[model samples]
Target: MSDNMFEFAFNPGEEVVIKIKAPDLKNKMGGETLQHLMGAKREMLLALRSLLDDAIARTDAADSPAEKTHIDIE
Candidate 1:
């Protein structure tokens, strides 16, 4: 993955709240809207895969050997 593919950001000293107003049903086209969202989700999955590849490469280079491994769920 290329660095230009996606971006991440943080707020230095504050939190933000966002609200979205969905399109009014009278103005919506069902099949078209569903197709658009499906395409967006596909792109999101591609982006996530790229990010994971980058992170794994960095971690493999930096980590020290340990005796045991563990997994946890949130």
Candidate 2:
């Protein structure tokens, strides 16, 4: 609906540096929208973390010569 979109970047070095674009609530959603969006984002991230952990456990438990090198979820 709006042109506004979230952006994230991760840079790897001795330590990983992560960057994220903060939402422009005033310009994009008028007022008080960021709070609602953030709540949803938090829940989504928690769910994603749980899913990834389960997948990793399953992969680790499987005894197979073929190993998973990459996974793409969209």
Number of the predicted model whose TM-score against the real structure is largest: 2
Q: lDDT by residue for model 1 over 1-74, one digit each (tens)?
A: 23232344558797543223333333454687767865765787777689779989989877967669688989
Give the Cα-based TM-score of candidate 2 against the true structure.
0.44
- The CA root-mean-square deviation of candidate 2, after full C-alpha superposition on the true structure, stands at 12.8
Estimate TM-scores for all models.
Answer: 0.43, 0.44
Candidate 2 ranges with C-alpha deviation above 4 Å: 1-26, 64-74
lDDT of each: 0.60, 0.63
Question: What does candidate 2's lDDT look like per residue over 1-74, in tens digits?
Answer: 23434344456655433333445556656345767887776886787689779989899888556766897899
Clashing pairs in 2: none
For candidate 1, the TM-score is 0.43
Error of 1 at 41 (Å): 1.3
